[model samples]
Target: MKGYVHSVESFSTLDGPGIRSVVFLQGCPLRCQYCHNPDTWQMNEGNLVDSAEVIARVLKNKNYIARNGGVTISGGEPTAQIDFLAELLKGFKEAGLHTAVDTSGYVDLDDIDRIIDDTDLFIVDIKHMDPEKCRELTGRSNEKVLALLGHLENLHQAVWIRNVLLPGFTDTEKHISDLCAYVQKLQNVQNFEVLPYHALAKAKYQDLDLPYKLDGISEFDSKQLLQYQDMIQKYYSKKFSIQHDAWM
Candidate 1:
């Protein structure tokens, strides 16, 4: 088996638990406005490597994973190549490695199940609670994403819900409140991470020759992020905290 891979980041820490190898799969179905990986959205475009070839490299980093965390698959939307992802996860699981997938939940439930059975963690991104706003922010509606979340819940899969806190897009009080309320209903959610938006990917957009959509949009204020974090905690606090240090 083979997969189209955009890039590989060995010894990545922020993607998942401890140390991890992040396989950035190519191709994404959703066009997110604040996407840092805009260059990865192109379908059928990337270096094709056989499963064994990739596994060989992954094994080299096994010690790092064991000592820290494990392996994490992030992507333009890893679900875009579902079967390849499942096979890769199977390899890692058999090696006794902790596996996690960072996804937008935009793929089919069948595909999700194929990998979820082997995956230990699901870092799901819920862009917006309002369907229309979700569609506007990311060219696709949240129906499929939400459906996938429901499936995870029903199957009792562990999940960490992530919402990129954007200034004008996803920071409104009404939206955050609704999102927190919705998340509270999901008993399977192990944690919630609120990521503050940064313009660190602006140069990447230029490199890809793609127009930067939120040019004038400033970075989210640290103070506001805490406000939202506190608000969300008020509703769902089993495990909720800022990605970095406490905002205040």
Candidate 2:
């Protein structure tokens, strides 16, 4: 099968464990205000690669993956290319490679299930706690995402939940507390990450000829994070830190 790809990072440390082959698939339905990879939102706008080619490259990095971590398929939304991912992950599994899918959780349950069957870990981005806010922030409702989480829980799949903590947009006290409460209901949640928003993607919006909505917005402060962290920690027993990579 063929998949549209925005780009590929051969060796990435922050994407997963030790070193990982991160495939940035193209096309997304969401219109996140703080999206860094604005260029990836367009469908069929990137390189077209065969699953066999991807698997071949990933196999060559097995030593690094075995030593560090594994391959993580990130995207404009990996579920958008479900069949391709299923094939790629199956091949990786055959080669004894650990596979992860980093997604927005906006997909058909059947497609997600197929990928999950071949996947080892699921790294998901929970856009918002409030359905209304979620719709506003991502151009769609969060019902599907919430349902995806519930499905993962029911299947006992390991998941790493991530939230972009945009100070004014997403870091409200009520929102954080609500998300904390919701996460408490899930099982097999391996980690929870709080990603603070930054203007690193402003240039991308400019290049795409799109308006950068969150312009002039300051990054989150230490105190703000502490307040939200304390609230989330009340529900989340596992502690997580802010990502420090260039992509964060």
TM-score of each: 0.94, 0.94
Model 1 spans > 4 angstroms off: 244-248
Please estimate how well model 2 matches the true structure, expressed as its whole-model Cα lDDT. Answer: 0.82
* Collision count for each candidate, in order: 2, 0
lDDT of 1: 0.85
Instruction: Please report, as a residue range, the 10-residue window in candidate 2 with the lowest summed lDDT.
Output: 239-248
Error at 240, model 1, angstroms: 1.1
Q: Output the number of the lDDT-best candidate.
A: 1
RMSD of 2: 1.6
Q: Model 1: which residue pairs collide?
A: 18-69, 19-69
Which lDDT value does model 1 have at 23? 86
**Model 2, position 248: C-alpha lDDT score:** 31
